[model samples]
Target: MQKHALPETVGKNIKTKLMLSATPLRRLSQATATAALGLTMLTAIGTDPAKAVNLKTFNISGNFASTALDGSIGLPVNLANGSFNGAYTVDVDQLPASNSFVNLTSWNVNLVNENTVLGTLSNSLAGNTAYIQENKLAFSDAGLLTNENKNLYSLELDFDSNFTGTGITNDGKFLDNSDLGSVKSSGLTAVTFVKIEPVPEPQNLAGTAVIATIGLWLRRKQKG
Candidate 1:
């Protein structure tokens, strides 16, 4: 379901300037067609307590400005147009204590396909509470992981750990009447990074107030 809205400002400055990576092979834009993420390898990041960090959002975007559908090879995503967005948040607390994939309350992506195929889909996307995990994030249609193949329009996005330097690594499948005829399914990809932090607690003004009151009382006593 929809959660926090993705931040619109995440990758504003770098949109057109991001040159496509120099990957040599060509890629197809179809849902079934998988592309290599990039020279940086994507590995499954396990639950490491030492590396755990607070829940944060990631805004992912890139201009597909190269020929042959060239772009960064990050992980797959939920069959999504919304799920695959510029602003995506995830919670990565240390395991056993508690952890989850924060539902994206809102979604927006800045994808300019300078070339072609495989990008964000429609709003039919949804997520599962069970898919939440330590150092991981995931989303799909309304049901379990297995049901993705059956939906009329569906997509999936899985992130190993958004806290890393390369940004959110994603893997996913997508299906729409346009991509697969009547077949139901989903996937898209983006690799930019942004995080949301809790607002700081208001300064401890109560103590200052009490001190001021005492000082006033002392002054009054001296005057008397």
Candidate 2:
């Protein structure tokens, strides 16, 4: 599902320079490949809350330029073989409440490769929610855990807790086929980082609004 359109401005400056180059752009254009390389690292953080733990807001940077592939990696002849893979460091602080036994109340990741939209997927955690939460740890390598055999891509981490589960969440299908043409054709190896925030509960905001409104009414009555 297309949620928010990625900032077209995100790669505008770089793309312009590439257009001026004499080389004909092809699948996995150099410029776009680099961008995808960078975006992937940044996108990993959205996999969990632990990544942005302390800051009011923070972004985990992805270095697409460093890791993006050119049609060399295993991919279809018709598809840009610019497959990229890397590991991002995600801290426990970013995922605290859940790791501290809260488990994942809800989590989702939206992946778009080359301007193609990838649908969102998530795990309710089911009965294993508690174990998942408690097993969450701050200091761990958030993995770009992809399975070549299964063609699965996931952002994963080992919690410093003992729990066993085959799959927590998977986003491979989305990343592989999503409107990745923009990335591949642009010849830009790119990284796709996603910024995530806690979804605010309606009651929390509603309660504050009610209190403020009541206070205002009381003050007006006094003046009258």
Best model number under lDDT: 1
RMSD of 2: 30.9
Model 2 misplacement above 4 A = 1-68, 72-105, 112-116, 124-149, 156-194, 211-224
lDDT of all predictions: 0.37, 0.36
Off by over 4 Å in 1: 1-57, 62-85, 90-101, 109-132, 142-149, 152-224
TM-scores for all candidates? 0.28, 0.28
lDDT comparing candidate 2 with the true structure:
0.36
